[model samples]
Target: MGLFQPDTDIFCHRDALREDYQPDEIVGRDEELQQYIAALQPVINGDQPANVFLYGKAGVGKTACTRYLLSELKSDAVEYGVDLTTIRTNCEDLSTSYQVAIQLINDLRGSENRLKPTGYPRRQVNEWLWDELDSIGGTIIIVFDEVDHIEDDSILYQIPRARANGNLKEAKVGIIGISNDFKFRESLSSKVQSSLCEKELQFPAYNANELRTILRQRADTAFYEDVVPREVIAKCAAFGARDAGDARQSLDLLMEAGDIAVEQDADQVTEAHVDEARAALERSRIVDGVAGLTQQGHLVLYALVMLHEEGKTPTRARAIQDRYKIVCDRAAVDSLVPRRMRDHLNELAMLGIASRVERNKGEVGGRYYEYSLDTNPDLLLEALDETVDMVGVTESIRKRRS
Candidate 1:
């Protein structure tokens, strides 16, 4: 038994990623870190009355910085007898104005040290939330993550002017909006644009060198010393930077590479190992993204791609329906037509998976069209864990000769 037979995976749970990962003390984000801290500085001095809007592309550390700064601001506010209440919500779930209000009231009541339910009426929740804030007689900071997903402007109108809202004769509120979508600021109603855009912080993508620094940091903190070589981290960083300069992607690549080395019972994760891991991770990520879609949408896409795989992929609506049933059977789900099927097809088209082609001459009227999958079905299914259905999808598959 040699000292270095192989560096198999020594799994560390912290390396596993959630959509929300704070990079604080994990990687270098000096510029982004300082801007965020400065923006929240006013809150500490009781001076920055304006709200902040933070924007950047996905995986660019926008949310992480906001969270880190807000946490610190709350801690410092305590010393000044500043009754600072920070309520964080994902705007995706609280899309509507009413949902936002309901969430705000619920959060506020919970923070009062006497965990009471808001119990406010549905129709009156927004009004009640405002009144409750007024009664608190202090400053409140509401941070909305994924703020672009907010369906309306009501919540924005209310937060910045919570003090002006007749009910807010007591407390004042400062808004902090975080969004991955850059258009969120411009898309806001003119009123919301003016108020919430008072201060803006933008996070840029990490460069290759930066990704390397990030990867090495995670390597040191997450893995046992020398468990993963510096070269492995470099490979992961280079791979991710070439793809999109995505830190999350780089981190995922490192984790995936480790898994590959482990599965192979190899002691060290090598370049070839990382390549195999990248392919596997890429497919898994794509599949996971698709799997998050509605079941029917998934079925429709799988059906079309499988049809393509079989060279029996028909492009017409009825043809798609036929393939869709085959897919449903493979998925062991019931077939749907007209309303449900149309809805699913439209969604697939929207996803850029399956697109509609013009119907040929003699085809039935009323928009008879061909539908096709953008990628190989097997690849997609592999990525999405849909391979389970491959053996059973209605179409008979002929194996290629090895």
Candidate 2:
């Protein structure tokens, strides 16, 4: 027998289950799709395209639906004999307006006339962007996905008003800004907000039944026939619904379960495989979450974990700060003050690794917040132990337990 079994392969096209995979047809987003198509209909009618904004929680169909419709729009534009140029850039990696402009310029001008990322004033960058758009000489739709990542709102204002401001003589520019941050629009200057928020659409989270349908469709393409059972898909969808109604999470769980089944030389993915995959995914998330923190962040979380193990949870910020100092000493690092430690605690809470609740101690005592670990303390300790040299930290915890 060979080292591996030829018949054990489960996946037909694994990429279909990936987060970035664009399906031929989007399921469970008809309302949102129609709204989006209405926003772009002006482009088809040879009118100025409206600036559209899409906002929602992550793992919803924001980016996917945008891409799917844009592709269709491009095809339709050709049949209408309209000159349409669509340029898409993910703003997550481009923080400043200048950076985004340089990217757009390079994308439109091609590599030969590309500008460097730096060494140019903001005005020059804007000029270069307008120049590129004018050269294209048609209705241009520029999409900035993860638009919240850009620190400067100047570009947001400049692009949407390019035509009215006489910046683009030939090309009419429309912007499609996509963000997971709900407060991103409010943070924008009033001027930029007016332009970009002309047509706003919100993508709600996918319900369990919706996720099930989506998973079934993707499963047909991603896995071979009869490899994934109906119950397995349902379980994955339920887990995703419980978490955040995230389709990406459900698909990831399904794909991971299939991989686990293959690894065990199993013939099909079952409920047990899905459970194991969920556990593996949870552990991976905990480890990756812990690893992404700053050194002080790690120490603070370790402190919280240690305190929780001692039944000292639901503790106050001052208590956490004191324990955090001991943790810092054990790790031979300087400790932050209580106020700064509170900030770290808040950051941890934001990451869902910890949570805070407020209580009142009557009129005299006023109100204060108590913090506790939101995740499994043992799993967190395991992740921290793997991520850093927690030998002294773990020993200190053992001493306290004794």
Candidate 3:
């Protein structure tokens, strides 16, 4: 009768689907795993490690596979009597080479000896890093997950060539750069590229079958027997495959469905639960995406949504500009110019909240672009209501939805 009573019906080991939970086996990435193992083979042989770069879309098992393989490599290295050390830090917050150097030094020094965020010269930071690396005096692998987030390539250039540059005498260091941006490699300077791209691997998206295999494994582990049906698994897999080909998305769908079933006091998860979960997730995504926009961005999106509701899109920026000005005035903010308005529209298209199409009118007229909402009208209106005062537009959209 307690409000927070535990429910044993749906999830047995829910942490199985948690982000930090590392699976013992990596499914749907056999080919990539073999190549990755080959790249790490030098570690076991007590040779200088290769600087490996892995590029792929998000949730394609790049980091998960790395963790799985590195765990095994660590085990094997111990048995083989290799002096190996692995340290990982996400680059999402560390922007400059100075920040990265500070982070690496702090990581090597442990939490009790952590460095302050500021008040250090760049050269001194690099020297401290080299000093720490030399102190370790063995093969060390430093992994920069989301490596593209770092603004400068100075660290990328230095780490791989630290020995040749006489920065370190004892320790042999290697870098593992994991990024979701495929173009990040091309953006690197030629010097940095030659060093970091010595060994590169691409992780492709998982198909429906592969997602099914992965979800089935987690479902079996996380839920009691027969709590998750094969049909529900297939539906989740298909939805994930069709949307982003992300294993994480499939797992999220399964987990959300289970939570919904438990909330409803049902005995088992069903396809209807998955459908409800998908709708809820889509709405959450829209809300989150909309929440990140600037005030002007919210105005622009509201204008586009109004146009979409009126069947005026995929219209041109000129049309959206007119409505946008009105929205800006209503919100008591100045409107942006046509060009700046188009920039927001393009950003919306990039975020998948809106769709853009380009048309050419032969050599005389040049090319023009049209824009429209790619998201659900009802959802966008609801999201906009939370961010901006679009009462007139909101009432219109909700009226149609009803």
Give the best candidate by lDDT. 3
Model 3 lDDT, residue 138, Cα: 84
User: Per-residue alpha-carbon lDDT of model 3 for 1-402, expressed as tens digits?
Assistant: 776977789999998987777887988899999999999999999999999999998989999998998899999989999888999999999998888999999999997778899999888889999999999988899999999999999999999999999999999999999999989999999999999989999998899999999999899899999999999999999999998799888898888999999999999999999999999998998999999998888889888987887788889899999999988887778888899999999989878899899999889978999888899877887788887564366776668757
Candidate 3 lDDT (Cα, 0 to 1): 0.91
Q: Poorest 10 consecutive residues of model 1 by lDDT? A: 393-402
Q: Which pairs of residues collide in candidate 3? A: none
- What is the per-residue lDDT of model 2 for residues 345-372, given as tens digits with 9 covering 90 to 100? 9988877789999999999999999999
TM-scores of all candidate predictions against the true structure:
0.71, 0.91, 0.92
Q: Residue 152, candidate 1: how far off, in angstroms?
A: 1.3
Off by over 4 Å in 1: 1-26, 79-81, 111-123, 262-266, 289-378, 381-402
The global C-alpha lDDT for each of the candidates, from Candidate 1 onward, is 0.71, 0.89, 0.91
Indicate whether candidate 1 or candidate 3 has the larger TM-score. 3
lDDT of 1 by residue, 122-181 (tens): 557767776777777667788888888778877787778766656576676788888877
Candidate 3 segments whose C-alpha is farther than 4 A from its true place = 312-323, 337-343, 346-351, 355-371, 396-402
